[model samples]
Target: MEAWLLLLACLLIPFVVLLIAQRGAGKTKNGSRIPPGPLALPVLGSLLWLRHSSADLEPLLTRLFARHGPVVSLRAGSRLSIYVADRRVAHAALVERGAALADRPPATRALLGESDNTISRANYGPAWRLLRRNLVSETLHPSRVRLFAPARSWVRGVLADKLLRESEQAPPRGVMVVEAFRYAMFCLLVLMCFGERLDEAAVRAIGAAQRDWLMYVARKTSVFLFWPAVTKHLFRGRLKTGFALRRRQKELFLPLIEARRARKDRISRGAGAAAALKADTTFEHSYVDTLLDIKLPDEGGRALTDDEMANLCSEFLTAGTDTTTTALQWIMAELVKNPRIQENLYNEIKATTSGPEEVTEEEVNKMPYLKAVVLEGLRKHPPGHFVLAHKAAEDIEISGYLFPKGATVNFMIADMGRDEREWQKPTEFVPERFLPGGDGEGVDVTGSREIRMMPFGVGRRICAGLGIAMLHLEYFVAVLVKEFEWKEVPGDEVDLAEKTEFTIVMAKPLRARLVPRSRN
Candidate 1:
């Protein structure tokens, strides 16, 4: 009887909350209607539909858009989520009137693990600006990015050597490249974050910790979204697991962070101390180093706490590694499937470079075809189908639909890129479309003006690591193609079918036969 009462209370609480919250939810003060969606049941909202559907939200959303229109709203208990599938509407909301929609939803704080503290999840205001500015200026700026060239080169070598060894081991069946791709990215990002050339065992440990935390948040934390206060007690086991994962992240990261902090302190002491630290260090600057120097004026000029630093470092590692690895896998898979395109890209790389030395950043910039291949890959298989959800700062209307101040609004990133209105053949993998005389020529990915495709997103909330992410993708893809001729394995064909995870990854992890090309 007591258990039944508890379950009844759990169900009733959210219903009552939704009843109170829905008072004026569908209309703005001016009486404009919100985007139309399915008629949500009282208390339950559209969650019944969600419960019945598979993990992937796209198929369900696609059907809803077919019935409702480009903009669709779905209520999950007390929270109202608005999804936009039209490009013009997305452009208007995210670009033309971006400030009105720049804020992150409050629930993101819990869902994304300390969203208020990190640059990606922080609410738009002074805190967000400060964090974003520090990251851009200290780490991602062009001049600063040049400092990490050696790190990228080293990671490239690590990736190439691993792939060559794996190909040698499994010559007939081809090598499963996803794990190699993920590990190589982690190595590069871990170096950039902590400013060390860690042994493979150390790198793997940190990567495992980060991945565990991310996967937990992505899969398990959503249950607590409606009312975390109540669910915390009800789902104590999950809560405990989440805390354990976070603790593991701190254990792995804090040591590296402390080492950098110690180095920073020693360098400040005198020339002798600085020389000693520099002699042992692998790189000059790191994401953690910049983070350590930050003093938040809004927070009494206090330096960030150990927790905040760990969270930021975790973000730095995950953000740089996961999306890049996913995109690289998709891009390489496409090359394997289409041998002609692969040969064309290889020819371009060959023509541009003097010989088969690793393709430098400069030579990569010169190859239009390589740039187009990367662009097409992003457009076709965006790492995340939706950009991190944005909140409507105020009641904002776009294309005649009202988005109330607190509602969560997310743009359909994959839909926008695949919109037949924008591209000639949206589904096909054609890099040439981004070249001159093609529809995508001179397309602005930043979406400052128009948004044909937004893999990195647009407006104030655009990805901070856009420049570096592009460089990594281009450089690695160039090197891989230059070193190997990626071909489809017999009976183990490249499958484009995707399964949603933290990002959309190929359902069948890309297994490709690699033929080592002789250097000229």
Candidate 2:
């Protein structure tokens, strides 16, 4: 009888300890109460519900949101994730109760790798606040972004030259402009990041390396995230490869960064206030410069470390390049599918241009129809299907749904972009719908109220690169339309299917015929 009692005690002890640990996990950060969420299994939590592929994720999330209401919570290990699908609930979590949801989810620390550097990955603290303020005031301020125009123009010219070469050699039907588009976008961002206009050879090498590194990171990241302990020990070689890639990127950027530092130091010694007064046009002001000059609200009175700077640089380049290029490809594919919309956009461009050389930024901005077409493109295909995961900072009741502290919150950017309730004929590619008097006029993108189509996301965590992204999209669309008349190749229709690679990118690359509008 005593032996039997000992066996039962052994089993009960483990179970009791687990129950206490879970209870501890569910409690609010302040130790008040657990946030509301679904039931969890032992170690896995709700991760069993996670789809095998990111492709399956959106539909799964949609169904879950339908069943659970807007804010549904799930626990992975000890961590809780709050999925916020309803715009109103998102508003409550991200806005009215903003402070509570201001902190970033824990996944970011590992994925972004120690972040005092990048504006996007910084936590909701004084350092982040300072970084955000500096980004707004120093670099991405509209006038400052405007200083990037010449670099943009030079890259555009390079793209035009490439397209012209493609036109001369290849049959119109055989041309796939996707690579050209990627190269052009990468060149622009690289120049912005490094402040140097790299020749085609250099640009190609850097772009190729970046692409390989990004793809590897996306493919391998889930393993690292889910089972970090086992994976790190077992997969040390692959772990090193990831770290190697990170190091490669660091090495690539270091020379440029060092050069900038040296130049700044020289200027400081020579002219002092006189040189500092003028914007240095000798070299383009790179994104690195913005990082160097801007002071963060010091953490313990010390500046951010080099590792943080490297991580931040990685984020900037990755965010700007991968997302933008994916978007450009999708936009081009859409134009190919709906030839009439492409023609309409081209006609709008033609009306504004006295001559190809005469078309300027101001002139393009005036083309309301062109702007509408770009807006429609964004609506049809948001770059990120979901905003990168956000987390709850405190226990709060949103729409009667109890959000426990430290729950991961994710919003459906693509789903919101395509919601039938907000958008009329949501599935259709009707560019006209985005016109001033059209159905999309009342659609709020800025998310001053509830989010409508959050292509750039919403609230405090919204993309600082919004203005520059828009400018690039509009500028490229205008230039492409002005230079070539896009048509679907015979026996081909644009495949608008998506694949996830840190962004919702074209499942199939866009192949289209381009007839030079200039030559015609």
Candidate 3:
């Protein structure tokens, strides 16, 4: 019966898709100035030709950007979707008039499940403000981040060891270090989140659970995100898969969260922490501890649920790990592809420290070229080509386009960074461009005043993890570069081809040879 139903659905796929597409929906119903985009047929707006997945839509969107101006308007299902590729307009909207564009779409709730404490998906208001504040102020604060030094230092060694093992185990062709980079990042973030340093098996278990669920959220369940009233009823299969993934996530994360809660409870009394983390020299508090104490203002001053805690903690782990690891691989690939840049960066590192004893996070601050390299990597390829959809809180106008209230809007992050107007040789990996007197010099990453390149986004809803992310990229990239000479394999070359998943990543998964570099 299920197979027959699926087969019937498959046969009706084309008709169903056509019906879901609203061709005339993109028309200016109010007769106001609207952004120009591809013309559409009724029942299938411009979306008739596009797929909901990022990978499938990337090329189409690129073509759309080239056709329409920086701002393009299209209708997806029943909602008017606007894409912003212009940095100046993005600045005007997200920075100058941010309050109106701060809310996320309602469909983001699909990922949160029953949890509402997630900062990334929460609506723009007190609940969001409180959760984001708890993260930025208590957990990710500069002082609090500094306390994770032990975790970072530990991961540095683990990363080096893993890289050595992988390189040695590589086939004659080469080996892919993607898993190593990802695993190291997970270890660091897991320790930071749970206040526990897990082993390879345990770490991979948590990471598997996370990646499985995120994959579903990013692709499989996105159908529910567009016109959920209809998709919810029609897409029971996707929802069922999401629920199963959610269950597995809870099964894996609950014990961890519960353990921490128990420890916190014990500490609340005079019992103190169960001496489990006694050997840890640093980090008296964990991110989960911060989440446990949070009392949402909008929720009648009640504590967060386990589901909510899992979401927040998982958000921290995945957001920090995946993005940073992608960055590390990209930076390393760039260094391998361009040995001149790698050597120059190495010399910069040598100049910063007395000798080649691992690069400390503090030393990371003084390395301008290193900073520039990391910045350039982010510019060349931001994690997401586009940020999370930002809903307009009110009808706002920008760049000669009418933005309807409650419409979905997002910026083209990759395009803005690569805009020929703002960046010269936008796709090249030249860190010097960010140095003084260079075209990319003194580039404002925050996008506070100017709308240059904002990888972490800008305005009130800017990434709360921006500060710590920067530190991770700079610190780990420094350590990786300082320790080994990343070389492109003879038979296996580094392919810069990009594949979009949760983040736009190197399609080939960054295979390379690591030769230990001498401090000389």
Candidate 4:
């Protein structure tokens, strides 16, 4: 009986999709046409898109863009997805008309577990505004970020130690640094999330939980996005696995959250703020602490539930860790591939700092070449190939094409940075372009005015952690250069070939020979 029902639902879905597509097809709002692309079939929107993996989708989309202009529309299942490859169109839609295009498409609640409760996944509304403001002001604020300086220093040591130890152990082949980079980032983000300098064992447990949940969602649960009602019944085992992953995340994170809650309670009871601060050896502010304090006005001044808090913390950890780690790996790989650029950056670092101390954030601010190196990394290889998909909250027309309300829109992040029109030798890793009197001089990455390149996105929905991410990149890159001379292994040269995971990472995880520099 169950198999019969499943077969019947599958048979009915195509007609249902056709009915919806016909209703929206050739529909115009205010004398505007929807972007043109290959016609979507009855149930499967674009057969090429459905058949190709995201890694292979780029070449397919490139051909589609060449044929059907920069802005193209394709239907997949019941959803209309519009991909904008033009920078001007992206700026117009994401910046000039941000509010109309700021919202996120609805996510399957069972797949996400907490629905769209976290900031990134939440719809653009008062709740989003409140959550975003809380993060930017409370934890990610510069003043608050300064409080975590000691934490960054500690993580840097952890990274350096790991690399050094690994290099020693694997003398002939060189060390694979992606896992080290990831672990270091996880350690730092875990500290910020929980406000505890957890032991290595505890950090590894938390990191494993977060990574497991993220990989499951990115790999397994995305299938349920289409016809979730029907697919949920069909893929019950996978659905259960997703839920189990969420449960594992909660199990790892909730204890740390509750501990923070207890600390807050103790301070409230009578510990006194200064004394409480003194008693706790870790950083003063944490993401959890801020979440505990936020009262949702839209939800009648209610505090966030434990599940909601865990999800948010999960977002905070994954957001800072994966993207940053990916970017770091790409940047370091570039350094290994390009020796002259590495030496130039090392010279800049040496000129700025006198001794063998970890590069301070204040000192990193002064190194212009270091900044340029990091900027070029973002342009040449953005962490994410596409920003999170944006939904059209209302009818938004860009370049005379109508992006109707309820349609999903996304910008090609990698395409814009490599555009020949906006950049000179866009494919090359030339950090000097961002130096004074160069093509990319004074380039605003935020895409506030005009988008030369948008690594952290642009406008209202720009990444909340942009400032801190840049800082981490600069500080770590500067110190890493100062501490070691990165060289390509003789047989295994650094390969820039990329594979898309949670972010775009080197398909060959960077393995490079590290020669410790002389301090004296």
Q: Show where candidate 3 strays beyond 4 Å.
A: 1-32, 41-44, 50-55, 108-113, 225-227, 273-278, 281-283, 518-520
Clashing pairs in 3: 21-43, 23-45
Q: What is the lDDT of candidate 1?
A: 0.87
Task: Please give, for residues 277-365, the per-residue lDDT of candidate 3 as tens digits.
Answer: 45653246789888888887776899998888887878898889988888888888889899999999988998998785888887999
Instruction: State in Å the error of residue 280, model 1.
Output: 5.8
State the lDDT of candidate 4 residue by residue for 174-279, as single tens digits: 9999899989999999999989888889888888998887777667766666667778888889878878888888998899899888879988999865665644
Q: How close is candidate 4 to the true structure, as a TM-score?
A: 0.93
TM-score ranking, high to low: 4, 1, 3, 2
| Model 1 / residue 349 / CA error / Å | 0.6
Superposed on all Cα atoms, the candidates' RMSDs to the truth, in angstroms, are 4.0, 4.0, 5.7, 4.2
Give lDDT per model, in order.
0.87, 0.73, 0.81, 0.87
Candidate 2, residue 259: Cα displacement in angstroms equals 0.6
Q: How far out, in Å, is residue 317 in model 4?
A: 0.4
Better of 3 and 4 by TM-score: 4
TM-score for each predicted model, relative to the true structure = 0.93, 0.89, 0.91, 0.93
lDDT of 2 by residue, 1-520 (tens): 9999999999788866876687666444445444344556566666445544433666766776787665566665656666766777777766677777767765523643444455665568887887777767776788878888887788788888898788678774657777888889888787777677777887777777678777876676655555466666776777677777877777777776777676677676885534533254334477777677755546455655556666666677777777878788888788888888888888888888887583578887889877787788888898887776677776676666667666677887777778788778999989888776777875667686877788887777888788878888888888888888877878877888888776788877887778888567
Error of 4 at 490 (Å): 0.7
**Per-residue lDDT tens digits of candidate 1, residues 407-508?**
999999999999998789899999999999988999999999888899998898999999999999999999999999998889888889998888888999
